[model samples]
Target: MKILVLRFSSIGDIVLTTPVVRAIKQQVPGAEVHFATKPGYRSLLEANPYVDKAHYLNSSLRELVQELRVEQFDFIVDLHNNLRTSLIKLQLGVKSAAFDKLNWQKWLLVNLKINTLPQVHIVDRYLAAAAPLGVHNDGQGLDYFIPAEAEVSLTTLPAAFQQGYVAFAIGAQHATKRLPVERIIELCALLRQPVVLLGGPEDAANGQLVEAHFSNRDAEKSQSRILNACGQYSLNQSASLVRQAQFVISHDTGLMHIAAAFQKEIYSVWGNTVPAFGMYPYRTKYHILEVPGLECRPCSKIGYEKCPRGHFKCMRDIQFEPFFPAAPAAAAPASQNRVG
Candidate 1:
């Protein structure tokens, strides 16, 4: 059977859908799974062995839909569930299921602070979308496959970062989701291990500020050595860094999910967005550092370019704790999610 799974245009959201792709391939006999994502996200899925073929929406949706119709997929799994995917299913006229995004519950929580959303992780919800085909969660958590050719060699990094380091993913799609640069620098000062800053080209400027602060001779005398790897590595290369890191400190962004894929210890910092949104690190050891009582938080279901109330207290007020290489605290282990 040939099944098509659609989750277009994102680093983290697409990463979260990997289990659905894996289950459809592994559990369904002779199943051929095709994944649909935006052209720019090739790094995320191209290396995935379970994905039989990838359909990139590099052109118009109409054009892409025409291309998919030729495949004659037996079923459709719409993990994205956006207007575009809705149209694709309509055009194809196939049996399908879509992941529940819980927009109303999200609105209720964001607007009225009501906790009506399900406690299930979003990964389990994505897995449930495939239950119609007898696909079940493997309890193995998320998957991130790095091509052998793309694996970053630690020897190429600064000598200080060669042994072990903490990967600080310093970027988020929205500013409200990221800690301010000053806070990042302050946290870097608290870290006793080597530091590697990770982000996209857009985050290079902010990464530079943190890099410059740590590179100073006086700061270097007291703090861990820092390497600003912001725009230097591709997504997979950065994922390689995350895979090899002693621990990870990230914003609510894609790399955090990627770290979860590798089962890395993640210190996920929260900003305007709250963990109740169900996008927290799945099936991995993670600690959430958010301001305890912020009435202005969960400001938007997504996030704003700046805090809507202009206080930005969710990020500014989070306590910056120095990380120790001891048994992690707060977040439970991946084994606790032994059976999803």
Candidate 2:
């Protein structure tokens, strides 16, 4: 059987679909799996062995349709139920199944705050879309294959982190979903181990602030153990750092899902959005740190430029004690070690 799976952009959403792709390849006899995604995300699926082919949507709908038509896929699994995917499926005219995005429920929750949505995680919902094809969740978590070239050596990391370190994803697409710089500094101060801050170019400024904050602190009292790699490394190299970490602490963001792919212990911080939205880390043991009993929580399905309410108590009021037992100690220093 020739099967085509679709999930276009976004890092976390694409990572969440790995299980579905794996199940389709492993369970379906003689299956040839193809994944269609935006050209930019090709690297995300390039190293995935289960996918026989990776199709990039580089041009107009007509172009993509013509290209896919030549492949003659027996079925299409539409994990992204957006207008673009709809157009693609309509153009292909193939038997297709799409995951329930619960758009109406999300709309009601975001606009009306009605809690009628199911508590199921999004990954399970993605898998449900493939139920008709006899694909089952294999109990394995998300998958992220970092190419050998992207792997980083532990020796290349600072000396203090060589023994072990916590990977902290200090960035989010939306400011409301992210903890403020002060809050991040507070959390870092509380951690008893070394920490490596991770994020993209948008987060580079915040990373600099973090580094500077630690640098100005009294080095004798506490060791400055934070390494800012935001915008410095590629996505897969960040994944390599995540794989080496003893634990991961992050907000509701893409790196949180990437940590899940590594099966690392994750402490996820919830802000304007809650895990009730079902996009939390999949198939990994995790602890969610959110302010309970806040009626104003989950103010948005995605996130806001800033907290709509202004107070932003959801993230501001959360206590990090439960997530980190002992405050992180000062890092020893920089040293070179290789990470496999």
Which candidate ranks first by lDDT, i.e. highest?
1
Span of 10 residues, lowest total lDDT, candidate 1: 331-340
What's the TM-score of each model vs. the native? Answer: 0.94, 0.93
Please, what is the whole-model Cα lDDT of each candidate in the order they appear?
A: 0.87, 0.86
- In model 2, which runs have C-alpha deviations exceeding 4 angstroms? 220-223, 325-340
lDDT of 2 by residue, 1-340 (tens): 8999999979999999999999999999999999999988988998999999998888777788888999999999999999999998888888999999998898887788887889888999999998878999898888999999999999998778899999999999899999999999988888778789999999989988987888788467455688888999999999999999988889999899999999887778889887878987777767777887788877888888988888989989988765554643222112211111
lDDT by residue (tens digit), candidate 1, 56-130: 998699899999999999999999899999999999998999999999999998999887999888988898899
lDDT of 1 at 129: 92
Find the 10 residues in a row with the least total lDDT in model 2: 331-340
Q: Tell me how many clashing residue pairs each candidate has.
A: 0, 17
